[model samples]
Target chain A: MTGTEADHARHNARMLRIQQARAKMQARRTLERGLLIVHTGNGKGKSSSAFGMAIRSIGWGMKVGIVQYVKGSWETGEKNFFHAYPDLLTFEVMGEGFTWDTQDRARDIAAARAAWERSKELILDPDYDFIILDELNIVLRDDTLPIGEIVDFLKDRPLSKHICITGRNAKPALTELADLITEFGEVKHPFKAGFKAQKGVEY
Target chain B: MTGTEADHARHNARMLRIQQARAKMQARRTLERGLLIVHTGNGKGKSSSAFGMAIRSIGWGMKVGIVQYVKGSWETGEKNFFHAYPDLLTFEVMGEGFTWDTQDRARDIAAARAAWERSKELILDPDYDFIILDELNIVLRDDTLPIGEIVDFLKDRPLSKHICITGRNAKPALTELADLITEFGEVKHPFKAGFKAQKGVEY
Candidate 1:
């Protein structure tokens, strides 16, 4: 082969190598995956969103665990609905209604602590696909649980395990550490419009 | 009046009223507010399960809107992220990504048109609190828009609308109706391994 032809071939090989490298980089960019999420803010559907996710996960034939803090009474539709799918998911509500309704700080703390213990299993368990800590922010905000301890537990969880912490007023520390953070801000509310909370709608 | 006697009389009156209401015999179920939802099951964040409803709606301070049509796709890290907000209430994802991916066409069709055009206003107008069309089954499978008339107009709208749809088979009907419908299914997913999608973690 001529020297010029050989040089051309070398250049072509180098171009191919660069193209291959670019393709690999693109593939890597698209291959990203994992889980760490926080749903925070003064919106209404935080628990509902988490529940929907839990249900979807259950449908996928994945084991799901839920720890609902500060919402134990008043017969939630979700609790009833999920209960029907016993084989697919496991859920626990660790609350005694609203804090004002319960009016027992020590009892509330104990309930939250117990729920947290169960939540730890779901957060750390490799067998479980999702762990929902419902209304945990309320627990933290009310000083029912130690925020630092909760953060530490979450930070130390298995890399593959997914955790969902739902509630209003998510601490800045949690937000900063979260892989994904969402803040729900209120725009219009039925309560503000004189509409009473309706069953099968709000609760 | 004696305290005991007064209490007894009040209780008796309440009981009589209850009996009379029972005899009249009509269960009064609270009606769900009529809402128009647009769920296009064809996008990456589709089953992040409509963060628009779970987070943005809350930011808007509106009532909850939820419509889930599929199963799975719950583990994408958005579920936990959005559910943290309080104002953004209610989210429902059909959970299924695509019929071809799940190999269940019947389920997909059933889920797609479950409540067609019910979410039209939310898709078309900017007044809704939160409108989520979780995984719209029809659009993705047929590639036909879910609603011919509504979608075309939405494309050119300027309303501050909060809408989200998820699924792998976004049809023309959906594209027409959607202010935003994301399509997310596996181009080459990493879960084919012994790695089954985890519950709560993935969903």
Candidate 2:
């Protein structure tokens, strides 16, 4: 071949390879199944983070199951509002109020255990896409439930189930077992500075 | 109790009520936590959303961590290009190649799960304010690991932890548990008919 023709041939080959590479990359995609997430720390908004993920997942036409672990009875704007979503499934662990308000550890543990049971179904079922275990870490940390059993159960859950757990005092074992973990640190909190949490914002 | 003062008192009470109600509606604020979020979707700009959140969070002097999940093998122009923010924790998943190119599920899963494990430490550490689990859905759906367990773990995490899980097929359970959910439907995609994903824009 002529010098110019050979040069053109090499350039064309390189271009072809680049195009192929791009096509392959574009075609690569992963399917939707399950996840395990932990949101913990001193900063605020752990529930919000879990809830945010829940809402996004539902928007994709995925079935969602939520178990609010601790703050159950008191009216929450999110509970009132998010329950309206047809795709979202929700359960509150407590019956009337917080532990301090009710002053009953037995009641709290019973409620949390009940909620955890319900969550187990969702976690083990491949049919459900996402599961939110809100305030579960608090329960675990407070000795309301056995952490080892919980971790073991979670470790063996269905491959298709995606779970999100939110609360404070995330245990080291839990963190070690988690595929994804998040810790929130408080730098400047409105509440610590005497700013009461607003209704829709903080609640 | 006076008649003249009573009228003014009623008006003042009404104003207070209005202000309180408005404040309640806007009370919700994003959480601060050492959490990681992965934004991956076929639609577009998953990373852009993450970057936007990162910039906003960093502006508040909150430590931020980011690991670009996928698209690392090739030398993209956007590497180490965060406007000279040395404090931002950044890394690339470094696919070594695209998922299809590797064509090895075990290898892909290993790489993804490994990256996820590394991210787990950062997410659990309180030193960082925000951790972005970008494109994590892809890994979950790929059957790299058990997504259900992952979700369950997250739901019961620390109280202060804040997490963001972004990607298409966000899963129903995730949506149900999230505080805020946004779905970007494809009203019009440039690639639908026949257009290539633009550099810097799509990547």
TM-score of each model's B chain? 0.47, 0.73
Q: Write candidate 1's Cα lDDT for A1-203 as tens digits.
A: 78855754665566466667654654544322345567766645556567666655654566778788877454655565556656656778777666554545556668888998888877767787777888888888877799999888777777765677878888876766666555544434444444444433355
Calculate each model's fnat, 2 decimals: 0.05, 0.00
Chain A TM-scores of each predicted structure, in the order given, are: 0.81, 0.79
What candidate 1 gets wrong by more than 4 Å, as runs, is A1-26, A30-34, B1-203
Q: List iRMS (one decimal) for every candidate.
A: 14.6, 16.7
For residue A201, give model 1's deviation from the true position in Å.
3.3
Best by TM-score: 1
Please tell me which predicted candidate would have the highest DockQ against the true structure.
1
Name the top lDDT candidate.
2
